[model samples]
Target: MKSLYAATCALALALPAAAAELETYLEFEKAMPPGNLAIGPDGRMFMSVHEFYGPELRVVEVMPDGSTKPYPTEDWARAPQDDADGLNGVLGLRADRDGILWMLDGQGENQTGRIVGWDTKTETLHAIHYIGAPVARPTSFLNDLAVDRDHGAIYISDTGDGQNSAIIVVDLETGRARRVLEGSQYTIPEDTPMVIDGREITLGGNPAKIGINPITVDPTNTWVYFAPMTASAMYRIPTAALLDESLSDADLEAQVERYGDKPISDGSTVDTGGNVYITAMTDNALGVTKPDGSYEVLFQSDDELPWPDGFSIGADGYVYATINELHRSPALNNGEDASKGIYKIVRFKSLADAVSGR
Candidate 1:
């Protein structure tokens, strides 16, 4: 039998490269604009169909022939009515080394949120944890997440519509969760407008400002790196402090440190070498935040990458991202959906080997 690494390498070669540095892994029609994405241990790619398009299938598995099928099951992708495992609306998802896919359901302007884990290897439910009330408020938008199996915890970025943003830490063992750094400068958005393609993005006739949206953890799971979507700097906090229930909010705030400068980005993922690849939303590029707090662009294209929203490392030693034209959505385009061209999923080789699903 072939090894896992060898299998990944073989599958990667099936797709022809589109550019010198990037490969167009998949493309979709106008209706299936993708949100966040994850690749399983066996190279099966999954993504949440962008909620802005009001899709019937919320989560789907991208097939080898560029088609999509309801992930896990058709019922699980529909509205959460009778089936408890149904995904209401998912924006973020990640697959771990153990073959479990963890999906974050923000519930789309609803008051409650949830995290569901399914064991891909066994095709069975692994765990489900509800997040609401004290930890998540009515305005909470659970944008993205990072799984730290070493600490038995999952860190989420609650981009509370630019007002009450914070980091929510959930204990995998107890299912208890809490919000930290609430209303802090590091989590709230700066007074800046998001301008893409020479036009400022607006929602309801006002600038669409978002708080902490891009969040990721290093290969070792020692530090959590994050930043506000409208801000120009990245920050980090030790994972130990986030899981400690004894620490007060003030103590936790003290542990936060500015890691480096970053562009206005949407999602990020790290490699084994501590290099964080960030999606530069405004610049239409992907840049890396180095270990020494320096930044450089790895790839850029005006036509190919519009709003690069999510990031996930695959077993093939490549980082995958979704290029959805979110800025053209009705919410950001003043009540008119102006999006054109095919929604694309692209991949490029990572600078170093990565822990898949981070």
Candidate 2:
């Protein structure tokens, strides 16, 4: 006899055109700490645990019935307490073309960050690259990364403390990195202020300034889209221009294109069709930009999504997001602790259809 959870998941996955439905799949009891998420080809979810103390990374296998088995592996959980100089824990999870999971360890404040790859089959950990200063700012918060599997190059965003935000490019094969756009027009924050909860929030303590947060590459791997958390506008730079070593700063600056105004978005991902989905923290919604340059509210859930952070689109087309209440937490702003949780806007395409059709 199949369990109820399994039956529900079976029916959900069986529905071919059901991708557009707006639904809440799961929620954690306590607030989910800051983190990043990656969905493997097999549908298993890998998520990072961002906090002072907890499993540095966790793997959850969603059963056929929708129940989750959280098996925290030793290789992913081990922290170097003694070597406090190095990156201690994982912040972002991304799976490369070979089906191996890559974890971005943002060594906290003073330490150099590192990217570690885990073999899911053997549970072995391998250090692919260590991202540090001179090329990247010492205070660089290597927040998120996108990989070009074909070229073996990875692009990382350095959300510095202030106007020093930059984008660092790394050659996976050579283990060498270079800062492509530092203090460039596209790398800086926009001039528009972000109004959240009826009060304006400043970027790096400056009003109406731009501070780069999360970035995502288009499905075609042609463009990289980025936005500052404090600004509503989004911008993009062609991958050709960014990856070209010969392109002058002025030449690269002229190619930047302003995508348009979006909600206070944190993490972003693009589907196979070139539709970009952004986790809009302020609006409590997922903002969708279609290929035709039109924007629409794909889904909005005030109760389901609060301070939605990094998210990834599963091969099945489902978009999962982490709802971290950074704004609600007093530690960040006013000493208020807004509990965080992980939530998924299941059947995103179906929900997009339902919302737009209405």
Candidate 3:
């Protein structure tokens, strides 16, 4: 959704176009196109591949030198739906302050999912929390997750393949995962349509709309925020309400609050200072929302960041994003491979730096 005329003017004045800039951090010439990113406390960058053209590693660590290596072990990245190997599709990743790398791994065919906890210090996967049939159905599509280390819990957004969507929460201590607010208003997308560069997104000549996609937890872990891919409004529910198994589905859904609105965003991440940075794909720009709910256009370049899909914020106050040049793929152009290996992981200064005269 376009901003109000007055807000647009204020944002333009706040962030001068001349200062809007990004650096080419890493370029992928191979087929391992990235989907999302998470930066460790010590500054190591980990990314998810989300099943590329043929078969590639699902998770990798970006070395300081810019080379990529499969994380944990290559066996986990092995091709051919290895249930024994313990991972099918990795869509989201977040490294909490306690040195734990949390992942949302979903198996679409079986409609099964698991929230995994990888101990970066020990270099091993210490936990595998699964979502069973009653919660995650054949239609459920678990897209991304937000980690709440303060309460030892993790929240995931299940943006189903079709129209249905829901939120799933897991308790680390007992490894119990439950589906809350299934098919609720907060989880499903409204009537808003998705169009980029004056073209609609379609798969097999049908309009493709994604729901309940991007999710992020506030730095303080007070609330969990999520928004649909095709909707403008962002909603949040109290972290306590989500972790409270005593609450009924109706009671938990009642806690959802419409914090505000945002442009169509793909990926989101929150900094230690509590500012939320999101990739606004529609405007071909990056947006930053302050604590008070006001947002600004940090930058909107035409040539670069055409499809800012995911983000990872570094301790040095820089945010890294993967520009999958062709966002929704060549099928958006009638079944031709328009993407010519032009994928890049770009970095820009912090949101505060981008808006201020830094």
TM-score, one value per model: 0.90, 0.80, 0.87
lDDT of each residue in 246-303, candidate 1, tens digit only: 9998899899988888889999998887778899979988888877788878788889
Q: Which residue window of length 10 is worst by lDDT in model 1?
A: 11-20
lDDT of 2 by residue, 112-177 (tens): 777777676565664568887787676677777887766677788777754778888878788898
lDDT of 3 by residue, 1-358 (tens): 3568887678657543433676888888647777789889998889887553433688888888878898767877544354467467787888888778887887666446777788888888778888877878787878899888899888888888646688888888888788887778877877766677777767557776777888888778998888887777777889999988899988988899877667778888776655677788878888876566777777787677677888877777788888775544654657666665667798877755555445
Off-target runs (Cα >4 Å) in candidate 3 are 1-19, 80-83, 326-335, 352-358
Model number with the top TM-score: 1
The true-versus-predicted C-alpha distance at residue 5 of model 2, in Å, is 43
CA shift of 164, model 1, Å: 1.1
Worst 10 residues of 3 by lDDT: 77-86
In model 3, the Cα lDDT at residue 69 comes to 90
State which candidate, 1 or 2, has the greater TM-score.
1
Best by lDDT: 1
Give all candidates' CA lDDT scores.
0.85, 0.64, 0.76
